[model samples]
Target: MLHYPAATPSDPVDASDDAPEAGLLPRYLARIGYKGPVAPTLDVLAALQAAHIAAIPFEAIDALTGAAIDIGADAVDAKLIGGRRGGYCFEQNGLFLRVLQAIGFEAEGLLGRVRWMLPDDAPPTPRTHMVVRVMLAGRPWLADVGFGAAVPPQPLAMDSEEAQPTRHESYRIVRHGDVWQVAALIEAEWRTLYRLDSVPPPAIDYELGNWYTSAHPDSHFRHQLIAARTTAEARYGLRDNRLTTRLVDGRSDRRYLTADEIERVLSEIFLLPVRPHWRPAIERAATAEIVG
Candidate 1:
């Protein structure tokens, strides 16, 4: 079993806040299409999170293509902001954490054990997923834009057990024993998303998790093609070749994509750069055993 570090609220684990230069803030804002006021207020944080999930998509193309995943600040900025590409949790949340710090929001990174689709009898998993906790107006809010398909568009008040409405789904945070579990309401059933620890692990743990998730041969990201993006009206998800679109009003549609359509949807819908060398991998993932 993995040992998680414990810390009090006052001594929460802090990730590196060395934001790229002053110009990075503007570039990131432009990349996410956020034109709202930049401040440390809750409203601004909510707007920024909403805009980010809509703009910068979630993807694991590099892992599929057998490339090293870099979670460094400069690499994240270049790929997510400068390059026309999407990334998985570490890159997405890592970048968002830095951006929030740049905007002077009291924010830090948190780790979670993903239990989204695992069975009840499944064994314990590692702390792989990354999230953000923001302190504003004397309270903490959970803001995560890197959870792919079911990511919450708006920040959720950490103290509330009420069903919080977001752009797409309803999310609630519940305490179980010493841990907190984030769940989403799906088709009238509540599904656990992940289990989070209040005290964040050291930054080195994030680096290690990224390496396992992106580079390890047994990692699911290496075998699957996963991508997701959400707009104001609906949330789009692609697992392998199957594409699913869930509207805000509770209607959903699913369809499998051809190899040619895969390229189109990845480029046009998810806004990911389809490089020339990635054709073989794309074709393989498109033709794999279909599972929606």
Candidate 2:
């Protein structure tokens, strides 16, 4: 089995606050595959969000490999950007938030509950999810690229309940009291992704939440091989040994993955590379899993 290092949250993770150097913006722009304007305008926000989803991905490799999760923006830059890998919500949104701030966007961090996969009768899950809220033209827009589902390819308006179209699907938001629920149109049925309140979260709150969500022994990510990324055509998912793809026309594809195939898919589908030294750990993780 994989030997997981002890998770300690005493270490402080700090992101770079200095303005980007001459070449830094180009490098980051290359990473996200976005050549569009870096302005804080609405058009720029939507395009950048779409480019992020297309370039980066959502993966649970750290959780699966028992690696400690670091939610800092610089950590995101080094790991996700330099490493050419994808990350979960905290990392993804953290990196995006810094970019928006650098480019002069009034982007704020918000917490949301994970209610998408739970049973309809189940109570609200913890506020483990993080999303970026950008303000443009006196309106708030949500930019979330970390969700595994095939949600709207662009940011959804905070005040609009109408279904907004994207390159892939249509999505809308509904406000209830202090909470705002986001849903996507799938097969003509509106499915809830998650819900959030307008309250802004401090940096420390995010740190604590990231620690619990990623490092907690009983956390769902630690035990399961969960990964997902969406494109204009389909949404790819991985759970244990199953690789599932759901397309836009409602047709779906499912397949089982062998250990070798799993590694390959990690590179090809999820844009993650398993270092030669890390193979044993991944191998052990697969063997220890009941599904494999």
Candidate 3:
């Protein structure tokens, strides 16, 4: 069994100042393009999950720019409201947890190891991802909108074989021994992506993991630029300067873009506002790969 950090309010919300007036939820919904009234139940969780996957993308530009990825509520709010952009697992899941709390859901942060689709013989890398566990209607569900391609919109019931629908792919959670694994159906076969035990993780646990993901030399985010978004039938990924889109039918298309085109696509498709300094950084990184 994996050890998880205890839950403690990392950044306490002050009822006097930081509390969102009742209207705050509505504003957030509008910002995320949610077209329905705020439901009082776990329906809000589903709505927020969909809206987040649709609106706030899964991006990793901060690692390229050497910005410290912070995982606190105030920091997440600043990035969402002030920066006017999306972030990777730490920022996206952190903000999602805060929104769940604001709307009266019992949620807690959880950590997981990423098993990349590289190879089976590769060793598992631990403590590099963050997700959330929510207690709704006397049951626990997994909610993760930060993952780029395979994000599901609704909370998936733990230990369930039921196929859950999202804005993207069909997902299911299954238990193998003491470990719980979330799998996606590709070509009608289940693929075990990552596993997490029923361990409650605190905000500080994610903060440390975020640091390594953003700053560690061997981390994938350090050497490459990756931003991905998911639609119901397809998933698009920009890895380094190569753009690839894979369909549910197992068809994939890939193309390499110039540095200028990469920046343009980031602004146009991904909705990221790039600074002038980032342009040269991307060019240098992409050119280095070509020259080497």
Model 3 bad stretches (over 4 Å):
1-27, 118-121, 162-167, 187-189, 232-234, 246-252, 288-292
Worst 10 residues of 3 by lDDT: 1-10
Better of 1 and 3 by TM-score: 1
Colliding pairs, model 2:
none
Q: Estimate each model's TM-score.
A: 0.91, 0.85, 0.83
lDDT per residue for candidate 2 within 152-221, as digits (tens), equals 5677889889878775678889999989988877778887888897899888888887887888887778
Instruction: After the best TM-score superposition of candidate 1, give how far the Cα of residue 115 lies from its true spot, in angstroms.
Output: 0.3
RMSD of 1: 7.6
Residue pairs of candidate 3 with colliding backbone atoms: none
lDDT string for model 1 (1-292, tens) is 1121222222112234554356777778779876666767777777778788889999998998888989998898889999957898999999889888877889998999999887757888888899999998788889899999999888888888889877577899987776778999988888989989888789899999898899888788999999999888999999988999989887899998888999999999898888998888889877889643
Q: How much is 103 displaced in model 2, in angstroms? A: 1.1
Clashes of each: 0, 0, 0
